[model samples]
Target: MSILSDDIPALILIDIQKGFEDISSWGTERNNPEAEENARILLNLWRSKDFPIFHIQHCSSEPESLLNESNHGNDFKDIVSPLVGETIVKKNVNSAFIGTNLRKLLDTENISKVVIVGLTTDHCVSTTARMAGNYGYETYVVSDATATFDKVGVDGQLFSAQLMHETALASIHEEFGLVVSTKEIAQQIN
Candidate 1:
């Protein structure tokens, strides 16, 4: 009943890490509470259907990086858990497919479309969506499933966090990918 695609789509979650909530980084002003809420919604949908879900965590060897240590960087809370047979991917870059077995996993599952959700819309979310589109996968970016902080422009203008959020939603919705609400997505598979 999915209006988007019925070809077995996988929910691709990117960078929903504990470190991101720290809010002192560049994302502090851009990250929205809605991202966390939407992620939980997506998680519920995936669990209800027992569909393919892949959680991508970011990691780096650099001493000061956000996801440097295994113990601190690799833990996803109860709010996010791997289903019985779901895959977990650890990535260093924004693109979930880069340096990960994501492509192979999708191919193995015969998933031609991806329902993407998670944090920092301007960074990882946007990057992965662009990559997915370029890779020829039918991509759908959940509009409320992503968030970011407010940023200042070169002209000394400060952008509203909500506006930035809308821009990200606009950037992908019906352009690079289809943007749907969580309710719409849930009803499709419910």
Candidate 2:
């Protein structure tokens, strides 16, 4: 369900940069490839509608860090040409709004709702979603549009991609924003 008077919705894509995939942290994940494909679908839809699309790129000054690489670090690939003139917010942290003009940009555009879709569901995606909600903007997490890899827990147990996806949905779906699929999002926009 859409929020009240929330007609101006921007799709905020967080940390879908190249480094996230190439880094050793997630290079061998089962859902990595699928997640990229799903993200592409959502990006295409938003681009087609000419909606305001913003991308957050994570970069670190450390020379050896994945985000510091010249070629692969935090750069969008050729497969996705971010719409011309769309703002690309550079960030050094997980939350896109932190120390960035993202919040100001949204406020300038009078955007009350944000449709979030990007890589690594448990990291930047989750953090940014929560932050957006805290900022009083209606946030929607497009499920297939976000994905994460397996991570070992403190209990010496590994959480699979599917498990992470489900857990994220359960935890933040209703509180932060409605959890939706790419298909459902497209239907709503159409």
Candidate 3:
């Protein structure tokens, strides 16, 4: 009786790139300094089990963007860098499924469960989670393993990074996907 589905989940790590380190470009403040560590924990767990893993990279079309293909920021941070065997899905949009063989690869592997973890909980993480759920996969968005930067509203009101992160998780929980914690996921091991 595991907490997750019987089918082994495919870990989907989104945009854990060096570009996100340019905090000034992202926002004044970012939440979850330990996000990468938590994601690493899950990554290690999956590796121990020899489960599927997909490393989603954002290849920005904008020349000035840090994630642009021509820059060092496009490279993955060492902590969660993809190994030789992991699948790398590069996308220009927020969703990982767009313009990529993410679905085909998942289907090819016969994987129907996905555990999503990554940078900016409110943006790419949320978008990918929504699409994963809509695609009929058993999706789980790891709350502590995802984070976001502060955002300014249309009227210039500042929203804290923590607020954005929480709301995004809440929005997806039990609707588009299940929002879970890394500890909860680890406890299911056995």
Top candidate by lDDT = 3
Higher-TM-score candidate among 2 and 3?
Answer: 3
Can you write out model 2's per-residue Cα lDDT over 125-163, one digit (the tens) per residue? 888999999999899998887877777789978888778
- Error at 97, model 1, angstroms: 1.3
Model 2 misplaced stretches (Cα beyond 4 Å): 3-5, 69-71
The global C-alpha lDDT for each of the candidates, from Candidate 1 onward, is: 0.77, 0.77, 0.93
Task: Using TM-score, give the best candidate's number.
Answer: 3
Error of 2 at 27 (Å): 6.5
Model 3, 1-190: lDDT tens digits are 2545578889999999999998989999999999999999999999999989999999999999999999999999899998898889999999999899999999999998899999879999999999999999988999999999999999999999999999999999999989999998888754
- What is candidate 3's local distance difference test score? 0.93
Per-prediction count of colliding residue pairs? 7, 0, 1
Off by over 4 Å in 1: 1-5, 27-31, 70-74, 154-156
What lDDT score is found at residue 74 in candidate 3? Answer: 95
Q: What is candidate 1's local distance difference test score?
A: 0.77
Candidate 3 lands at a TM-score of 0.97
Worst 10 residues of 1 by lDDT: 69-78
